[model samples]
Target: MITEFQLLDAPAVPTVVVKRAEVAATHLPELFDATFARFHAAIAEGVVAPSGPPFGLYLRMEDTLDIEIGFPGVLQSPDENLVASELPAGRIASAQYWGSFDGLPLAWAEFVSHVAGQGLSVAGPCWESYVTMPEPNMDPTTIRTDLFCAVS
Candidate 1:
């Protein structure tokens, strides 16, 4: 669960982008693995310098989700396979979670409520950044994910 929330003006970061137009919720695990694999391969191939932690950008989520998975990076140049992109930019309602990712939905619920409590409207896409990435089979209690709800 979120312990606190904040409003911040965010700046976009360059990324090694992988996006899906449509994805079922059940398919998210595989998508993250494949997308991150591509990110690592690009790193191994020296295509981009890992500039920051990984992120999951959510454009829309209803019957299906519009998503982009990527790592903020300093690209050597634009590669066709890995498009160079940027994360959402502007004002945002932010929340920090320091537990298993399974608690994310609830965290988001609190984040929106907190934003509304402050008289703000969510106006754009949202995203979650992996501030400290968890290793394979790592204890979820140690994870750190920073969520952002873009707002007007």
Candidate 2:
């Protein structure tokens, strides 16, 4: 399920601690877990999130997905494990998604189709902002993910 799509001016994110990965679709869960684990470790080392929520930047989606996952904030100490980066400024077409993670592929496909139907060109990396992350004992239907695709 998804909410009505909206196009908004998305400002450039100045600070972020991201870990890039190239992995097959089947490994996403483990990839997210490890990436978030790196963020937690960075927090212990003085990284702060003064910007926005956690996000996954979908750079490329082919046979293997190229993704960068992390929180929006400064990575004071750059290391080999994690790098500092920013989300580009642009117009973003977005919608709120409801349900479990398993349905995201279809959701994204639908959303992308809708964006294309609007005649908006995808200008940059698409992303998903995690509004309500999955938790133990929580209903799968309660999950809320906000999808954003940078559009021209």
Which candidate ranks first by lDDT, i.e. highest? 1
Give the residue spans of candidate 1 off by over 4 A: none
Model 2 residue runs over 4 Å out of place are: none
**Clashing pairs counted in every model:** 0, 0
Tens-digit lDDT track of model 1 for 1-152: 77668888879777777878789988998998888888888888898788888999999999899988888887776677677778778998888888877778887888888888889989988889989777898989789899887898
Cα lDDT for residue 89, model 1?
81
Per-residue lDDT over 31-149 for candidate 2, one digit per residue giving the tens place of the 0 to 100 score = 88887887777778776543677888888988888888877777776566777777878798999999998999899988988898899878888989888979999999999999998
How well does each candidate superpose onto the true structure, as a TM-score? 0.91, 0.89
Which window of ten consecutive residues has the lowest lDDT sum in model 2?
14-23
